[model samples]
Target: MTRAFLGLGSNLGDRMGYLKDAVAAMDDCVAVSGIYETDPVGGPDQGRYLNVVAELDTSRSARDLLELCQMLEAAAERVRDVRWGPRTLDVDVLWVDGETVDEPDLVVPHPRMFERAFVMVPLGELAPDLAEGWSDPANGDCRRLGDWDELVPPASEGIS
Candidate 1:
């Protein structure tokens, strides 16, 4: 199985709820980084985003992972009325071990992952080796909110 990283964010409504639901939907999820609240990078003006990077050990290809990301976003009722616009949930296939996919809809190792602090900070928390020597990006402010377990409500409690 290849070890992959998925970046997740939500800002429209119940940001944390959207994140928790996405993380819970991944059957191969192995680890999740601490949450980071960051200013939206681009797109019409929008609220801050709650973000995290999740690790998964899976046999799925990069294309498959991209599909999964889209599925999660759809489940959150994400609308695409505007480019980089406010989203209920945003999921990206950040990296996939030993794989490179350059497709119209997907790109492995996310072309902009390294340029965004929201992605780098939490990613550093889970895989420092890949994030070593990485510093904050100039795009926006990013601050750690807390660990995933502490910030997200338990499934048993339900999301409301």
Candidate 2:
């Protein structure tokens, strides 16, 4: 299985639940970073977001993974009416096995991930050394939360 990195975020209803649900639906969840609350990126003024970086083991192709992400978004009632709009869930295929995928719809290594604290902060949790080197714009105030399980309890906790 390929080790893939996914950036998960939610700014709408049941933010943490939506993220956990999306994580539950995936395969081989290796590690999930602590949560971080941050301001919106490119959308209209909206609520802060609960975000994390999820490292997973998957055999699916990059394109397939993109589809899976979209499916999760739809299930979360994501609306694309606005660019970078508030969402119930936002799952971006950040990086997959250090490979570069530049499809018409998806971009691996997430083109602008380095410019956003929301992605870098939690990413630092999973991989400190690398996340430390990553430089973001420092505009958004990303606050680290307490515990990963507490903020987003595992399904085994009966948090379905």
Candidate 3:
């Protein structure tokens, strides 16, 4: 199994709900960083985003992981109308250990992960070593909201 990281973000309706559902949908998801709320970085002006980095241990190939990302986004009903536009849920395959993939629609080690504070800040919480030696970009405000368990209650928590 390989250790992989995925970045998740939502800026539209039910942002936190979308995130919680995405996390639950991931296969072999081992750990998740604290959630962060950050201002929109690009595209037309939009609301802030709730972001988190999820860790997974899986035997799936990078392409499969990409497919899983797309599946999760679709489950959240994500719409791709504009580049870098606001989204209900965005799942990015940030990194996959000992693996590299370069294609027209996919790239491993996400081309711009290091350049965004929204990605690095939460990522650092999950994997500090990987996040080391990276300079965060001055895009906009990004702050930790809470940890996974703190922010997303257990599915059965409120049940009788």
- In terms of TM-score, which candidate is strongest? 3
Note the residue pairs that clash in candidate 1. none
Encode model 3's per-residue lDDT on 1-160: one tens digit a residue.
9999999999999999999999998869999999899988879989999999999999988899999999999999899999999999999999999988889999998998988998998888889989888776675578888888998998999999
Per model, state how many residue pairs clash. 0, 0, 0
Residue pairs in clash, model 2: none
Cα error, residue 69 of model 3, in Å, equals 0.6
Q: Lowest-lDDT window of 10 residues in candidate 1?
A: 151-160
RMSD of 1: 2.0
Rank by TM-score (best first): 3, 1, 2
| Model 2 collision count | 0
* Candidate 3 Cα lDDT to native: 0.91
Ten-residue region with minimum lDDT total, candidate 2 = 151-160
Candidate 3 at residue 95, lDDT? Answer: 94
lDDT of 2 by residue, 1-160 (tens): 8877889999999998898899888876788988888888776889999999888888877788888899999999898888988889999988788578886898887888888899888877777755766766666798888667777655577755
Q: Each candidate's TM vs. the true structure?
A: 0.94, 0.90, 0.97
lDDT of 1: 0.92
